[model samples]
Target: MKRIPDEVLDHIVEICNDEAALVVLSCASKRLRSRVACRQEAWRKRFERQFLQSNDSEQKWLHQHMRAKRAATHLGDTTSILLFPQGSAQFDWFDAYCERRAVEYRWRHGKYAAHRLTNTANVRPRGVRLQSILCAFDYSPAGDVAVVSQWLIASPRQSAWFSEPLYWGDMDTEDVVVLSKRQSDEYLVIQAWNMLVDCYSLCVWHTAAPHRPPRTIITDKREIPDVSLRGSWLAHRIAHSADTGQYGAAFVYDLARGACYSDIQGNIHTCCSLNATTDRMRIVCVEYNKSTSSPVTIAYKLWQVAPDRAEPMQCQATGRKAMSLKQGDIKLQRIDDGKFILYSRETDDLDPISAPTISLVEVVDEASGVLLKEKWSLGIRVMDIRSIASHDLFSIQQTYDKWLLLSLIDGSEVRRVHFNCWICSGLYPPDDQWAKMIDDSMWWNPRDDPTLHIHEEASQELSPAAIVYGHDDAITVVDYTGCMHRSEHQQGVERLSIEIRNRRIAERKHLVAEDKRIAAKRKLLLPEGVRMRTEGAHLRDKSKRMREEGEHIFTESMRMRDEDSRVYDKGKRMFTESMQMRDEGRRLCDEGRRILDECEHLTAKLQEIRAQIRALDST
Candidate 1:
């Protein structure tokens, strides 16, 4: 392996897509280390391809160094969404890429510190410590605690001025209405409804100006419609109901400029989702055809939403007929120009025998009609798809138990969580260094590291930066923001993972050796020792027979005493206590058996010691 030329090895590492494998391969020799360092250009390209591309250009993450370069090109008007809003330093592209992998490793293993929403908030009470659970998980569900809909969003170590908890109380279905991705530090969007007035209000609460009243717009609807937030715009749609002659009007509200746009949507399904961006929005619903004569079909409809209008784009059927119950949601994303990806998880009665339940469909809305081009099965169910903070990776709650980080660009699974814990996305920490989005290419060994041993716990996704978990008594906030792009932490962690892997291998070998030693001990006890033990067991059989007879007599006597001695209840407590213990005759016989067993053990030990001595003398 060492004899390979440096030129060939450099290409080998360049082709090595796995981060863990690359890091391990780098340790193979000095030439490989130099080869990895030389391929910084390759790392930068891979990093930019994975981490830099978001749906809209506004959301595309830019590093500080890239910002400077773009600033020069744009005549100092350099503006783009920051990959890590909290991060200030300029990192090497290779360093950023590797650090991004380390951060994913933290997510794969569920490594974070969790304080309750209350504890992480401003109201730090004296007894709040009781609610806080501190540990790296083994993936066990924190005991079943009631789900808290209330939330207080603030950065860790916000100064005394921002220390007070921003009180956002419970919603019937409490999901935070995101303001601007950048303005998230200062303002938060919330929903406040007046049941009596039947008016729903979308309000923006300012943290710094807590004394001032919130700027709000009244959503003129009886019930809250399905709302989706992206950047500064909030788009919501009411489900189409035929009885009321409602065509399911969808509304897009620009929370930034106080402008509203509406369009009459045709029959938006109840269980559909609306994905929004600054420029455009996409909504999906189950397509139903009311024809008793027609065959049963399971199909869904997609609609492209403009600022002024909405149009149903296309309808694609899963080629499945559900005779029984089949219900789930869908997620939509526009990858590139004219290209879109749809992930749908609808139950089918014949799914287990047919194919995987979740469908990953890549389509293009072209004049040539290519909506169902490349569809693949994910082998897991999708609860929600979350963009990992720093990378182009997306986290999917696979089952009720498992969570996986998937490549957002290609929808390929990167790293899966160690424990089968179910985590719901609560908040996403900043995607600081998720620059070049791809999975680390290490051979996955679940029990390789103790830090990754997790139990099946339930948590939520807060942000790409942090994980919010609720399993037991309190809701916990698990922050993974530390490993976002810390250079000091990155190499050390990769090295530590290697160390842990080696240590686990050594421990397994030690266990195998111990098993062999025990096997050898059994072999030594096969012939003469077995005969002696058999004779000893034969002698002890008489003692056991005597004890059994005595126990039977005691049992019969106790039964007679209970039935007949009810009137004469003297020393009844003592007699009952005596029944719990062996009688004197049985106790004596048992003591003799114990002595004989000890004698056999001592004889065996003596023989082992003498054998060892004889072997030493021969040596």
Candidate 2:
């Protein structure tokens, strides 16, 4: 009501945390509307409560919560990840959430629409304008029709860079390995391994200016094959050359500034691992003695690539502080902060005193190479670690069939999950089935076939954290968060949820109808030539009308001018007469003044007589 205070309404809104309520209240009265519209602090509080405060930091957390919320809604299993339209902005929390929601929806409920690229003849299709697609395919951020294959990015409608294709004929699809591709509103950076030259090529292109050829830089060394892009910075490793005999180097390039920062070289064999954080990149390398086979000296070279402290590319070889390990290939896994897990697995025979060592996992500071804690082991030996999240390291021990997740910080076991099937990771396909998949034309589509359909709805009791699709097409997600299945909730919210869904459906339909109406109206518009002809004809008619009106206006304007001049002449004569009258009035006023002066003197005497009479009367 108008009588209700805005402070009361604001308090209610804050307590309710309902944007819809806020909208309704804003429309109720002008004063309320002003408060709602002008006050950004209220919106900030709402944003903090709805998005930030309730642990929406990690993508995994969002994925689990949204899915759980959807399941609790009692709707069908089809959950949309991207519930809202994507907002266009860089590093917006709301925009990120929208994109991530869509991603989660795609992973869960979205169906795949397959588009044929190459024809049966292993060439571009008849209507298609794109060149032949090369090796692997990577999708753009807006995962629609376009497929970025090797150097050429092709869409169903047409290929990008239509006039001048970016494809180099000499470069093979196999040779051009795409290391990392980063897309922003202003620019796109495709860092690919130029295997032909044995170097990494930083391909930068302006999305706004697609006609201009992309700027590219081929690294001087061929050994830096791998590249990782974090925000505007790119992290890469320098290849180890036998001729140089020095440890491999790590390079960091700022995409925004176009500056390169390299780390000092140590006795590195090859860059074993590289990871990029918010601002810096950590590179790990291994070094071993070439001569002595027995008691073989092994060490890891740790280098950091930061903006201010980055070593120059041509910096002299400084001896890197080595973290000593024994008898096997050393591997480094980067964790959160400047920490990493240094690990190696081996069967020892040379050490006579101590029992033969099986495996070792040690946590160390990535920057200083200092041991953080004593090595942690849970009886079994782990060969490799694979993880979806940075904090959770998933690995299968040498003796176990099931994969176990270990905390990166303390090397403590988080959980163990069994997988019936899994796809092997490598460049080469493991079997004929995988080889067939790569060759098959229609294998990549994510459809609801007998092979791809999950059909695990009946077993909702086993809450899954994620649903992973393996080589066999059996879908199963790693379960830990317990949100994969049906969730129990307080009663009476079903109707509310249904109402909300109905409202959304209505809004969507209205938008679609509006769009269609606009489109149809646009289509009914005249063609360019027709429009131009019509506009020209209209202009000509308008000009003719304007000319006729101008003629009439000109005639009227001349007549009025003549009348105005006659009136002005008459007024001038009248003004002269008035001036003479004013002079006569001035002369009369002077005469009147002289009379008034004499009258005043006489009045002074009269006043004196009156005063004397008044005095006599008083006496």
Clashes of each: 41, 12
Candidate 1: residue 262 lDDT (0-100): 60
Give candidates' CA RMSD values in order. 28.8, 34.7
The CA lDDT of each predicted structure is 0.47, 0.44
Per TM-score, the best of the predicted structures is 1
Q: Residue 178 error for model 2, in Å?
A: 6.6
Give me the displacement of residue 182 in model 1, in angstroms.
14
* 393-422 per-residue lDDT for model 1 (tens digits): 556655665566777566686653322221
Output the lDDT of residue 492, model 2: 24
The Cα RMSD in angstroms, rounded to one decimal, for candidate 1 relative to the true structure is: 28.8
Strongest candidate by lDDT: 1
Q: Which ten residues in a row have the lowest lDDT in candidate 1?
A: 127-136
How far is 86's C-alpha from truth in model 2 (Å)? 23
